[model samples]
Target: MQYSVLGTTGVKVSKICLGTATFGVAPTAQDADRIVGAAIDLGINFVDTADVYGNMPVFDRPGAPAAADREPAEQILGRTLRGRRDRMVIATKSNGIVGLDINDRGLSRRHVIRQVETSLRRLETDYIDLYYAHDPDPDTPMEQTLAAYDDLIRQGKIRYVGLSNHPAWQVTHALWIADDRRQQAPVAAQVKYNLIDRSAERELGPACDRFGLSIIPYAPLHGGLLADLRVLDREVSGDQRFQGSGFSESEIATAREVERLSRAWGLAPYQTSLAWLLSRPAVASAIVGAETVDELHANATAADVELEPAQLASLTALADQPPAFQHRAGDGPERPPATTSSDPTA
Candidate 1:
């Protein structure tokens, strides 16, 4: 497997990170054990999970059980990594409602501190390699949130800090706060970046480049849309992400184009998609989840598939274009009031 430096940190991580969002949900605990074991054999050293990932149905169903009542992904991972904890760079997040208490969510000092303790216990680990604020909390002051992270680092609870699902402005603001306070700054940013959605390239890409942060992109396959375009033609079964209505026509067309290009290049659709993402600027790793050992083996091969410059450009051009927004008339440089001054010098 190819390895890269995580942001400006000296730590080396595998190009592919094993995502555990589906653990104990789609795949049972036994299935997770095999999948994780396969990832280790494939040389993947990074795993990403969260406190609220194991019980995803609760968010969709109104009367579903509370998240705390379900077995979280962290606990499943803990059992799976009993003898092999040191072999992976573990990353998890907080800021989601995991309990019924009013103080159970957000990036407040209380929530952050409480969740870290719970996560450590569930993961059976002394220190988490990276901890993320899963989402931005507008109610809590950034200073309070950052200060809590700084304190955690000093106490050796988490080695590094990261942010997920936060805008570019908020990311830069957090960095500024860390710099001004001499606290532990974030080294990575996680977002839903994939072949189908290239929105992160608009601002987060540049922000990460300027601030020395690595982009760890999740959903690199766009919920299996890029993996196989044929799913659009057939009736998709068992996959909750595409059960009700499936993808939009435009989305399907985009995936079909990606498939055509992959065939022309003599590569599988998934390999082509993942290779293109790994080649993008500021991207350190792409997180992929698998339901079985065979699937994990297939996805891990993308780490070694290097695309040619032309191939990379083709996939980039096929990505969904960002929505257009007209700039206000006065936003740009004025035309010098119709250039009434005749002199070129004027």
Candidate 2:
């Protein structure tokens, strides 16, 4: 596995970070353990998860059989990493209105402090290497949230803080606040990027470039749409791609075209999509979810799928279209290119 510096932080992280959302959500603890071990064996040093991830029911239902032993997701992950804490850069998030109480969610000082303690306890870690505000909290002032993050850094509870699914302006303001206040600056920003999605290019992409924030992109393969036609069909039916906002029919067709190009290039559709994502320097890691070792191995091998300039150009041109909302002069559907951002609160 190859590695890259995470933004200006100078921390070396694997280009392919293993996302743990699937680890404890559907897969049993034993299965999740094997997957985590497999990821480590493959040299993946970054793992991403969230407090909300633990609460997701299997098959998206309200109540399903919990993974073996019925442990919460974070607890299972913590148990799996019993003696390997220092071996990986673990990142997680907070900010979901988990319960009906007001303090149960949002990025308020009360919530951030309370949640961090809960997260550390659940993950069996004293300090979180990276902490993220899952989404913009309209209820909480930016200064209040930044101060809370500052307190964590000062207390050594979190090494760095980041924002996901936030508008560029908010991210920029937070960075300035941290700088002026002389607090720990956000070292990274996680967004969504894929062969079918280029929306980040407009604001977040450029913002990261100017601010030197590492991009931990999720759904690098458009949540399996670019994996294969069957998965693409399932994704369309499920409306879970693009951070669960679903995709246009034209977007689905465009995803299929990307898959066809991958076959023509003698690569797995997923590999091609991942390889394309890795080519960009701003991306610190692409968090890909997998259920088995075979799937993990296939994704890990994407590091070797080098694309020539010509092939890259062809794939980009084919998938590069305006957002579906745009209209064309000739009256042809102005299918928008695929674009995904960090997972927003739904």
TM-score for each predicted model, relative to the true structure: 0.88, 0.86
Model 2: clashing residue pairs? 196-338, 197-338, 197-339, 322-336, 323-336, 324-336
Highest TM-score: give the candidate number: 1
Cα lDDT of model 1 by residue, 196-229, tens digit: 7787888888999999999999889887888876
The sequence of per-residue lDDT tens digits that candidate 2 reaches over residues 1-346 is 9898887777798988887765544465668888889899999999888877744543242233543435556677888888998898889998865667757888889898998998899889999989998877766777778889989999999988888876577677777667767777777888777778776666777788789988888878776777766774452322341134565787788777887888888888888888888886577789987756887888998876789988888777866652421111222322221222221221
Computed on alpha carbons, the lDDT of every model, listed in order, comes to 0.82, 0.75
For residue 77, model 1's alpha carbon misses the true position, in angstroms, by 0.2
Q: After superposition, how far is residue 59 of candidate 1 from its true place, in Å?
A: 7.6
**Residue 65, model 1, lDDT:** 41
In terms of TM-score, how similar is model 1 to the real structure?
0.88
